[model samples]
Target: MSAVIDIEELRSQFLDQEFDSQEFVLKTENILTVARASGETRAEFSDESHPDFQAPPALLCSLASGRHLPIDFPAMGGIPMDGGKAVTRHAPVRPNQTLIGKTHLHDIYDKKGRSGRMILIVARMEVYDTDDNHLATADSRMVIREKPTS
Candidate 1:
């Protein structure tokens, strides 16, 4: 196992600070391609020619900033792995529009698991349009655990 980690200290140092930002242009063709590859049959998601064509709900899951997590995360001395991701959409992502994704460290915590103690770090990305309209938020969870030794 790792040394004692100060969760509150890390949270205070990282949380609320913007670590990375990226801009994504939602193109019609790209949206259609992603939709089709994901086996989407909805006209609005898969058909660009549709009057109400828009990106699928899961599209934001693929949009990420340059850095997944803050580079200076506290060393928990464990094997880090991708826990999972969650996305929430507030508005339709239409084609030919630019969306800005700003990423920050949202939270940190530790819990005991079947094998040992594990630390979970949550990174949040807030998506907004040029008009400063909140469009979506994606939270990426990373798990840190010690290597199992027989």
Candidate 2:
């Protein structure tokens, strides 16, 4: 199998490049929903006007951060897989506040496995607040598997 795009070119075009930051407002309803679904009894996650209303830890990176992808993936005609994500929280994420974050292509490469040629693209995102205080970083990896030819 052959790569759909030049691997090196993809890296040069995306890696370490910062994109425009996007704002994600932590709605009260969403926070409450997640807290209830997670079987959490803490009022911080559901109480919008509470002074301690904080976002659920697991929801920090759940704001569709991929919407800020720095680069667009070409049609590779391959199956895509969510390789998972790693997040390092630097501060508490709260609700009823606008959060700003941007995503960048952190790394990209290709590999050959028993299934076929696989391409891995990793994206890194930094979340912050209106004051520009860093809150967390999440790295999400996506894998593309080459399509089988008849």
lDDT (CA) per prediction: 0.82, 0.77
Q: Each candidate: RMSD to true structure?
A: 2.5, 2.8
Q: lDDT of candidate 2?
A: 0.77
Give the best candidate by TM-score: 1
10 residues in a row with least lDDT, candidate 2: 64-73
Candidate 1 structure quality by residue, lDDT tens digits, 1-150:
435677788888888799898899888888988898999998989888898898886678777524667778655666678898889989888898999999988888889878887878888899999999998898888898844444
| Residue-by-residue lDDT tens digits, candidate 2, 1-150 | 544567898788778888756788877788889989999888777677778788887687575345534546566776667787778889878767788877888898999998877888887888899899998887877888867655
Model 1: which residue pairs collide? Answer: none
